[model samples]
Target: MHIEQLKQKIVAALEDLKAQDLTILDVKAATSVTDYMIIASGTSSRQVMALARNVQSTAKELDVELLGMEGLDAGEWVLVDLGDILVHLMQPQIRELYDLEKLWGEFANPINHQA
Candidate 1:
């Protein structure tokens, strides 16, 4: 699938599960690992795990390769690695503590997903 389509599918998967504070960071210039980093928060550990699962399912449905996943056991944070994109699902407190937006702030452009 195209990158944009893959992104949309991933975002929709998160939104379907009511993921909060969805932020898409264009990190093409900052990192070589992935072109985009999607960050979102879940209200609780269960929600975080659910969101990650949904994203994984969506990627599978779209035939996107799932490179890796992490932090699912603890559910404090979950990282879904697609070849060109990385999805981060975390509880609100963990999200606030890590401050990924700020970490990538300098080089990442926050894409406005608003209509």
Candidate 2:
């Protein structure tokens, strides 16, 4: 499957798992680091790790080659990079500190969810 389709599948799965405050930013015009940025939160460190793990597993099942990650060791924040699509699974406190959603105002929408 195309990377964009794979990335969207991952996002939908995350939302199914209630990844809080999920935000999808179209960064194509903003930066070269990636085309899309997916920022999501978990209620706790453990849940954050679980959410990251789920993303990893889903990628594996879909046969998408995903970039390996770090921060799962700390369980505070985890990043799953699928090339053009980057996913951040973070704890509430960590997310608050980062404030990623606010950083990308252009991709704003009425998602109305907080994992």
Best by lDDT: 1
How does each model score on lDDT? 0.93, 0.80
**lDDT (Cα, tens digit) per residue for candidate 1, span 8-102:** 98999999999999999999988898999999999999999999999999988888889999999999999999979999999999999999999
- TM-scores for all candidates: the values are 0.97, 0.84
lDDT of 2 by residue, 1-115 (tens): 8866876788888877878878777777777887777888899888888888889888889887787677998889899888778888989888889888787766543233344
Report RMSD for candidate 2.
2.9
The runs of at least 3 residues in candidate 1 whose Cα sits more than 4 Å from the true structure, single-residue gaps closed, are none
